[model samples]
Target chain A: MVKSKSWTMVKHFEGLPKLEDFKLEEKELPPLKDGELLLESVFLSVDPYMRPYSKRMMKPGDVMIGSQVARVVESKNPAFEVGTYHVTNVGWTTHFISDGAGFQSLPKEWPENLPRSLAVGAAGMPGYTAYFGLLEICNPKEGEVVLVNCAAGAVGSLVGQIAKIKGCKVVGSAGSDDKVTYLKEIGFDEAFNYKTVNSLEEALKNASPEGYDCYFENVGGNYADVALQQMKQFGRISVCGAISLYNDSVPATGPYIQTYMLFKQLRMEGFLVTRWMQRYPEAQKHLLKWIAEGKLKYHEHVTNGFENMPAGFIGMLTGENIGKAVIKV
Target chain B: MVKSKSWTMVKHFEGLPKLEDFKLEEKELPPLKDGELLLESVFLSVDPYMRPYSKRMMKPGDVMIGSQVARVVESKNPAFEVGTYHVTNVGWTTHFISDGAGFQSLPKEWPENLPRSLAVGAAGMPGYTAYFGLLEICNPKEGEVVLVNCAAGAVGSLVGQIAKIKGCKVVGSAGSDDKVTYLKEIGFDEAFNYKTVNSLEEALKNASPEGYDCYFENVGGNYADVALQQMKQFGRISVCGAISLYNDSVPATGPYIQTYMLFKQLRMEGFLVTRWMQRYPEAQKHLLKWIAEGKLKYHEHVTNGFENMPAGFIGMLTGENIGKAVIKV
Candidate 1:
């Protein structure tokens, strides 16, 4: 019998998620099935979408859902060999059994010096989400303006950079000066600390005076509405997430923009990276190439130990992470 | 001097527009310049979009903005021969002076059998809007389900028909029983009076067990939010207009849909027909062909005399018109 640790949702969150809402427990694996491979949790990813989707897609007693990069220590499936790294949707567990079907086998050609934790950060869901979401949905053209919110976070940071790669003028909104500086360092043409900004519309207009042609909306609420107004005709909005109103104590309102979209002729699309899972390897190929070329930069705010998953998730919710928030065991 | 009567906005309205809010003015037109043409209104089209844009885009004292099919009475511009028909952005005025740039000669292939008033309704902006907005943004795949609100209106009617032509199941929501029946008679898969439906969600669910794959949103507010929840994963929403909340005395408050869009991976795009004017000829090509092939149909709720423009506008807003509302002069 193998002992593994897992975090389970103990209670629903009303506002900010507390450490008490999650409880960690130890379990013993009975045995691996014929097609299942035993993965030893190495790094866990804490993302904002998990906060809302857990309340939606999971029962209270169910294990908290998330993704992690793990090493295949023992395998019943021939496709996954021992000592190979893989990205799997095994949740907040220290050990998990996954079939080769949905699990991705990370390339062994990856530079040995590069952190393997990036498999969940820049090179994993966050990276591909930014890549495909911007390239596919935003469909950015050269000289076009691309605006990203939460630009310091996991997905938004990469979104801005990728839009730049596609020959777009990238503008970003972050919560802090450090993140804004980091965004500027990463080739974002314009970056603002939305926390200090008095008016969202003024800040957005200042950053993008000509108006944004493509808006990557990871932050919803007032920021989105202001951005909606500043969009040029036929502009595209890629709605990856809405972190602002996820844990509201009461239903939220404002940015009253349902009508503006029609007059401005804007397009806002929400996407899940899984929608492009079929072409995930294709995305990884380009991402890996970008990393190899030093054209892509990834930052990780890792919380050490399995018991700290809640803290990591809470940290991410509060915008404590620079690029991607990860839990390392 | 030429005597021509016109309707001018006396003041902005508080709720539904009333006749008292407009002032009737008989103006003497000055002589046309050497390069200008004199136009006399023949047919006028009333649409819902004018209601909202007027408050923001128009000042306290400006000629009412609308498209009109007019006949040139006298011309110095060679393009406009006297007695020639043209579509001009000539507002609500009975007469106006324009150079060649203000008008386009009515297409020779234009159906003489069809009412010339349709050039402003079914075969004009509303018709072209439904064609492009639905096909391009919604992109309904075969066997997918499509839903449209205000289905008896000019834009909504055409949206439902286009979805049907694309081999998708079509459902529509109307404000009254007669319009509901008319939607079914025109071959809607399901048509319901939203006013009579006890629960919009239940009605939509019962109507779309498989879930709506494409939504042509003309009505905003709770109706859109409820329809949004019923959308299938990867659904597409074309934000054509929001007629439901157009006349609201106050702003609308409802559940925020940005979160739902992310989970469902839905795509919502807003569009105006003018953005595609570079391809305007193509719209005429497709809409005219569809009409000739009997794959498409048109309805006009004609009210005689131009004096009723305000009443016509209000009637259109209140959903009194079964289809396109036209004021025949």
Candidate 2:
């Protein structure tokens, strides 16, 4: 029998999700069937999308749905061998029975001596999200100005670096001075701490004199509106996520932006990475190549132990995590 | 000698625009030099973008700028002969002198079947605006749900029809019952009069069950918020214009859609059609071909008399005109 400790949703939230909403449950795993394998969770990803999506998709009394990097310990399935690393969206469980489905076996030919935790991060889904979102949707051209928020984080960091590789001037906005410094270190031409800024519009105008050509939006609210006022005549905005108001008790009712969009004639689009899942491998190939060439870098804030998953998740929602927030099991 | 009368801006409006804001002045004819060609205005194209952009780009007491199709009545240059038509950004002038290099010349090949007024309306900027804005920015795929506000107007009408041609189910929202009917008649899968609807979200929920994949937003405020909530995963929003909140004195707000963009992982883009000026011929060729094949249709809300251009503009702002608002000077 495989021993497992799982974080199950014991309650739901109205505003900011609380730790009490989750319960630490202990369970015994059954023996692997002929086609099944026993896997141990090595890492768990805690993302902002899960919070709102859980309120709608997942219910109370269920293991939180999330992606993880795991190692197969024992297997009746020949495809998943012992000590093999695989990436799966298997939620917060410590051990799971796998039937060799919904799991991608890590390639043996990956860059020599790469960390396995990144299989759930930069070299994985979020990296591909930034790749397809910026290149395909935003279509930033050479000499164009590209701005991305959460600049030091997983997706934003990759987005800025990718734009830099494409020969575009990259600008980024993060929550702290350290994060802002981190963004510059990663090749961003301009980076600002939104927290220290008096006005987002003023900050943007001060940074980009001709206005931003393309914006990869991850943070919403006043920040988006501020960027809106400083866009070029024909700008493109890729709306990947709005982290600012994910846990809002009320709705956003500040200055409206629809008029500005029409006046500037800007284009804004939102995307789910799954929309390009068919082209996932293509994105991964480009991203990994960049990584190998030292053109792309990623950071993960790993919260030690499976018991700290909820704290890791809440910290990410509050913009506390520096990069991709993960719970190391 | 060329005689001309042009409307100059007399004052800025505090609220509703009046006749005093503009003053029509006739200037005595100046003899055309060797390189000058005298032109008479035949058609004037009026649009919403001029309202706010003028406040920034144009100073008070300057001539109100607009585009018109003018006939070269007399010319001292060999480059332009009599009976040739040219489109000029010559403002509210009845007659002017051009050097033939300043304005775009309209070809005289197909004058019999096509309307000359189309040079300032459908065959010109607004038509191409609808074409590129809908196709390039939105990029709607087959079986996708497309929502267009101001569906009976020039750009939105074409957007709905083109979306239909692209195999997307289109829903349109208009301000009046007549416009709603017109939208339905123009191949819109569903059309609703927003004026009669009690709640925008409810109407959207009723019209789009599977959720919207592309939204061509012309009217903003509550309408935009409602449409945003209805967007599916990875939805695309093309912000063309916002006629709804243009005249408001206070900052606009409603629906609080910041969280929705992130939740749906939505993408909204705003674009000025003029950004594709270098590619105008490409879009024009496609639009003309669509017209030739009867795949596209358009309407012009013509207001005759040059002196009454302000009246038509005010009416269009109040949502009275259905289609491309223009003045037959």
Candidate 3:
């Protein structure tokens, strides 16, 4: 028998999540059945998506939903070998018994020196999100300008870098000066501290005088309203996340944007990374190769210990982390 | 010399346009030069686009821009013979000399029994706007549910009807009970008066228990905010117009909709009909055929005389017209 510890939501989040709202629970698992495997979480990811998704998908006392990099400790399946690392979405659990279903091993060409936590970060969901959201949706062309918000976050960081790799001028906005520096270090052409800016409109205008061809939207609200006004004709907006509005109990109201959209002939689309699940391998292959070539740089904000999962989640939602927020167990 | 009488904006409209904002000016035209033709306006169109466009495109002294079906009274251009009718965008003018640069003649197969005013109504810009906005942007698949607001107006009525023709279940919302009746008369699967509905959400849900797949958005504001919530996953919104928001001196405030759009994976695009100008003939061909086959029905709210041009325009913007609003000059 194996003892597994997990975090469960005591109640649905009212606004921002609180540490008291999470309860630690433990259970002793029965012996693995045929073809089942025992796995222990190595690195657990706490993304911005969990905040709003929790309200919609989870009830009180439900285990916090998330993805983690896990190691197979014991296996009864013929195809499985103990000690192999894999990425799985088994929520915020320390140890889990699985039937070896929905477990994705790291890419075959993954560099041995690189951390496997990347399976839930750089070369994982966030990477795939930046890949398709920018390339497929925004479709930035060479010499064109691309704008991204949440510049230091997992997806937004990759989005800006990828836009650079595609020969497009990239402008990014983040909450802090440190994040602004990190953005510049990762090859963003222009970076701004949105919190310190006198005017967001002026900041955006000063960054790109001509106007943006593509906007990778992560923080929606007043930011989106202002950014939309600065889009060139036929600009495409790929909305991957709206971290700014995730904690609002009631939606924040802003200026109606239909007029801007109509006159500019803009296209705005919202998508989850899973929309292109079948193409994950293709995205992972590119992400791994780019990282190996030093073309794609990654950063992880790891919170030590599984006991700090709720704090890690809350911190990420509050924009405390500069990159992918993960718990090292 | 032919005398041309045109309506000019006396001043920029502060809110909704009034008669005092217009000034009728008359000028005598010189004889037509080589390749030029003299035409008299037969039927001038008064559309919702003029309201918003007037603010963006016209100055205080500029003529009110619009399209009209004109009779070629005299011709120096051999290509355009006298006594023939052509569609030209010459603003709100009764008589003008054209260089035949932007004149479009009626389709060759136009039925003799059908009124030529249809050139600017059912078979004209409104028709093309509906065809491409719905077909190209919404791209409704067979048996899918389509939701169209402003379902009795020029472009929207055609959108709902076209969705029906494509074998989709069409739900429509209009301002008045009579407009709702007109929607049902035109083969809409479900029609409701948005003004009379107790709750717009319930009305939409009752109209179609399953959510909408293709949303032809003409009326923006609260309607869009509510409709967006009820969209099925992967819903495509074709934003042809925003008549509801056009009259606002300052933009109206509304709930930020990025969350609903994100989880639903909805795509919302705003367009001007002119974007598909290259494919106008393709749309006109289908529209003309549909009208001839009695598959498409059309209604005109004819405002008599050139003198009522401003009133006709204001009335159309206020949603007084059930279908295409045109002035007989």
Candidate 4:
């Protein structure tokens, strides 16, 4: 028998989730059954989707839903051998048990130079999301201008870099000056602190005088409305996340975009990373090659200790962290 | 030399367009040069796009921009012989001299049974808008549910019928009970008067218990926001127009759709009919076949005389026309 610690939802989040909304509890696991494997969580991921999705899909007293990179401690399943790393949605847990179903084993030849924590960060779901959303949804062509909101965060950072790699002029908006600087350092053609800008429209117009050909939407609301107006004819928008509205106590409202969308012939598509589940390995391989070739870079804002998961999650929602927000147990 | 009477924009539209905003002026035509043809306007189109686009694209002294089906009275060009009809964006003109630069000749073999006015209506831009917007953008599969707003209008009416032809259940919303009846008579699976519905969401839920797989948005604003919430996972939206906000005195605003779109993994694309210009003849052939086989039907609300053009335009904007609104000259 092994003792495992986990965070459980004690109450449904009303607006911004508080630490009291979750309860850290302990459970004693019985011996694993024949196809089961015991997992020890190495790093847990906290993302924007968890906030709104919890209110919609989760019930009180349920194990909080999240993804993590874990090591196989004991395995009866040959597919998930002991000492191999795997990514699983085992929530905010220090340990878990899985039957190898819904578990993705890390590539056997994962470059030793890269951090294993990337299984939950870049080179993982966030990386794959930026890959497919930009390449597939936006289908950006070389010499086109691409704009990303919430840049310096996991997905947005990767989106800008990937657009650059594809020969696009990349512009990004971040919440802080440090983030703006970081984005510029990471090869964004232009980076602005959205919070300090007098007008988002002015900032965007100044950044890309010709207008954007592709928009990677992460921070929705008024920002999205402004961005929509600045899009060139036949532009494409990938609606990945709406972090600005995830914790809204009131229903979110913004300037109607139909008129602009219609005249410009814009295509705005909303998507989840899971839509490309079948092609995960393909994306993973390309992302790995990009990283190894020095064409891609990744950052992780990691908080140590399992007990600090709630704080880490709250900080991420408030834009307190740059890059992928993760908890190292 | 011949005198041609034309409507010219005297002032930009303030709220809703007024008759005095345009000046009916007569101009003496110059002699046709080689490759030029003399055109006599037969049918002029009055569409929702004219209202907003006029203000955006037209200068105060420019002719009111519009498309018209014209008879080639005298042809210096071999391609456009006398008595042949063609569609040209010659504005609100009773006669014009065109060099055939932007003119599309009507199909060489005219269906004697179908009205020639259709060359500017159903068989024209509006019809093709519905065809490509639904089939290409929404891509409705068999057994799916489709919903169209402004359902009795030209594009929306065609959208519902096309969805039905594709083996999808069709639900529609129109402004009046008569329009609803017209939609049902045209083979819509379900139709509703949006004004009478206590709750649009409830109306949608009752109409499509399984939720919609595709949404053809012709009316935007509160209706679009409500329809978005009723969409099933992985639904597609084809945004053709937004007549609801065309004459808005204030900027239009609606509920933020990013959260719903993200969770449902929905795709909403806005398009102009011109996007399918390269494949126009292909779509026109399919539409003509559907009409000839009686699988597709068309209705036109025609206002007589060229002078009634403004009234036709105003009436259409106010939802007075049941189908494609046009003016017979």
Q: Which candidate's TM-score is highest? A: 3
Q: Would you list the C-alpha lDDT of every candidate in the order shown?
A: 0.87, 0.82, 0.92, 0.90
Each model's TM-score for chain A is 0.96, 0.97, 0.99, 0.98
* Residue-by-residue lDDT tens digits, candidate 2, A1-329: 66888888886676788899889988898877899989899988888778777878787898888888899899899887899889988789899897978777778776766677777778888888899989988899999999999887778999999999999999899999889988888889999998899877878877788899999988877788778778887788887888776677677677778777776767676677887888888887888888888998778898998988999888888778777888898
Between candidates 1 and 2, name the one with more favorable lDDT. 1
Candidate 1 lDDT score at position A273: 85
> Largest DockQ belongs to which candidate?
3
lDDT for each residue of candidate 1 in A95-162, tens digit (9 for 90 to 100): 97778777776788877878888888888889989999999999999999999999999999899888
lDDT of 4 at A180: 90
Q: Write the per-residue lDDT of candidate 4 for residues A1-329, one digit (tens) a residue.
A: 89999898998988889989989999999899998989999999998889988988889988889999999999998877799999998788888888978788898999999999888777999999999999999999999999999899989999999999999999999999999988988899999999999999999999999999999999889889899989999999999999989888887887788888888989888999888999999989888898889888888899999999999999999898889999999
Candidate 4 segments exceeding 4 Å error: B31-35
Clashing pairs in 4: none
Candidate 1 lDDT for residue A290: 84
Residue-level error in angstroms, candidate 1, position A306:
1.6
**In candidate 1, which residue pairs get closer than 3 Å at backbone N, Cα or C atoms, i.e. clash?**
none
Task: Between candidates 1 and 3, name the one with more favorable DockQ.
Answer: 3
Q: Rank candidates by DockQ, best first.
A: 3, 4, 1, 2
> Where does candidate 1 chain A have its weakest 10-residue lDDT segment?
A249-258
Give all TM-scores, in the order shown: 0.94, 0.91, 0.98, 0.97
When 1 and 2 are scored with TM-score, the better candidate is: 1
Local error of candidate 4 at A222, Å? Answer: 1.2
**lDDT tens readout by residue for model 3, A82-155:** 98889999899999988887778875556898999999998999999999999999999999999999999999
lDDT of 2 by residue, B1-329 (tens): 45589888786654556767888888977888898889999988778766765666677888888888899899999989898998899788999887877577776574476677776666678777777887887889999999998888778888888888899999999989999988878788889998899888888888988889888888877778767878888787888887677667787777456567655777676777777888776766676667767787778898999989888877777778888888887
lDDT of 3 by residue, B1-329 (tens): 77899999998898889999999999999988888889999999998888899998999999999999999999998999898899999899999998888677886667987889988988999999999999998999999999999999988899988998999999999999999999999999999999999999999999999999999988889999999989999999998888889889988999998888788999999999899888888888899899988899999999998999999998988889998999998
DockQ of 3: 0.88
Writing each residue's lDDT as its tens digit, candidate 4 over B1-329 gives: 89999888899888888878878889899999999889999999999899889878999989899999999999899978899998999789999998888777789897889988887777889889999999999999999999999889988899999999999999999999999999989999999999999999999999998899999998889888888888999999988998888888687887788888788989988998997888878877888889889998899999999877887888898899999998999
